[model samples]
Target: MSTSTRAGSAAPSIALNFDSIAAARAIVPRLAAISERSEQLRRLDDEAASLLRGSGLARVITPRAFAGLEMSPSAHIRACAEVAHGCAAASWVLMVCVAHDYVIGRFPEACQKEVYEGDADNLIAGALAPQGTLERTPEGWRLNGRWQFGSGCDHSPWLLMGARVANPEAGGYLTYHVVVRQSDMEIDDTWRTLGMRGTGSKDLVARNVLVPDHRAVPTYPTFIGQSPHATAPTYRLPVFAGLPCMLSGSVLGMAEAGLEAFIGHTKSRRDVTGASKSANANMQQRVAESSAEIAAARRLLESACDRFDVAWRR
Candidate 1:
């Protein structure tokens, strides 16, 4: 299908679905198994990545036309939270993957087709920070430089890189999104961290990789909703409006995981003050407070997502 028509026809609905929750549950154990390995290796294991792909968890934010679930932002948030309950790094990777799909949807239809049409389930990894240089080339442009914090690189088949095209006439830099196949670039294993180690977020280097004009998107234009893609109602929605909610969902999930651990510890813990931990007023109060905090955070996230849906409808 043509990219424009496919984008228009595949505009995502704002409603949440049961499948998203089910996917979250099914992937939680897989995340747990790989959590330790990710920490030890400072990256996600191949097994965990495959499991996530098999679970269709990565498709939550993918456009429906691309065989994605087209889940509402709220659903995406909830799912990430559930995954974070098992492993923060896994949840973070899932959040980034889903967000990257959303960003790709906002690109020119040609770009979308080039990245997703052949293998709708292909994993894409890279940092969004604009740190590379773009020099004009005959076909499109040659991208050069390095980007760090590329999460899920070990499992991704493609990388989405951000670079600046120097507009001498305009006397400024124009940020652009460039797609490079995995083979064209190098992945550096430098993901040392105190937490969220399984993310495998390292650095990506692109040296004079040629990208076609159809595949390069100007970042600023997208911010104002001037994407090359046709304006479907979904496309008309603000660029990156759903991203923060997705990130917050992962944080909320990790918090929930901490709460669970606290509960487990308290159940059998003895207070240092001689009182039974569960019987102590302070411990009871802490448990109540944590539960309330988690509940409040969930409500806030859902409310924000609800607002995003309402905005999209307009």
Candidate 2:
């Protein structure tokens, strides 16, 4: 069953059945095993990328027509959290890749088909900062700029890069976005980060690449819920509004992992004075405080997801 479809397209009658969080959790062992290698490479290893793609977690926001999950935002957050429990870098990359699928759904139908057809598992990486300079051309827009923080670009075949277009009528520039094939661009290995090193969020450079008109989109419509092409309810939500929830899942997951590690260490740890850390009053208090904080963070994330789901559904 193909799961790729265009924006404003109708959802399939039968829901695509899959446990997104379960799928995420099942991959934790492999992700954990490769954490050190991923960190060392400053990017996700090819094995880890293949594992994530094969797991179907990468298609959480892809249209059902393209054999994607088309999952809700809340579900996506939950799934991301589960993935982060194994590896933060992997989870961060997943969040960007999956979210880009949703962003592409807001573009023109031709652009959607160009990326999703013949490749149901196709991944898209994106950089939303308006750093590109767009020039009008006979066929379409000519984009020439360098986009940074192109997360998961190492594994992507396409990219949605943000740019600024000179508006003759308005006397200034308008925010524009273009979708381009990765083959048409150059990748610079500049992703050196203290955290999320495995995401491979390097810089992508495009020089005078002509993006077809069908592949270009303005950011205003999507940001203000005014996209005439976006008929799906998911596309109607404000773009910036849901990003916080997407990022919070990883934070919560990391907190959970830290708490677990601390407790495990405390179980068999000795203080400077040769006392058992887990048995000491101060150590016990710290552990209790950390556990409480993690629990509180989980509740906040759940509440945020609940609110987003309710608003999007309505």
Measured by lDDT, the strongest candidate is: 2
**True-vs-predicted CA distance for residue 248, candidate 2, Å:** 1.1
In candidate 2, what are the lDDT values of residues 1-314, reduced to their tens digit?
Answer: 42234333344223236677889999999999988888999888888888788888877777655566555677778888988888988888888877777777777767877888767566688788889888887887888889899988988999988888855333133887788999999999998879778889999998999999888887777666566756666767777876778888877887898788888877998878998888999888888888898899899989988886676555
Clashing pairs in 1: none
Q: Write the per-residue lDDT of candidate 1 for residues 29-132, one digit (tens) a residue.
A: 87786689878888877777776677777776665556655555666677788888777888888888777776776776667667777566667787788898
Write down the lDDT of every candidate, Cα atoms only: 0.75, 0.79
Task: Report clash pairs, candidate 2.
Answer: 2-65, 2-67, 3-64, 3-65, 3-66, 3-67, 4-65, 4-66
Clash numbers, per candidate: 0, 8
**Backbone clashes in model 1:** 0
lDDT value for model 1: 0.75
Model 1 vs. true fold: TM? 0.88
How much is the lDDT of residue 157 in candidate 2?
A: 92
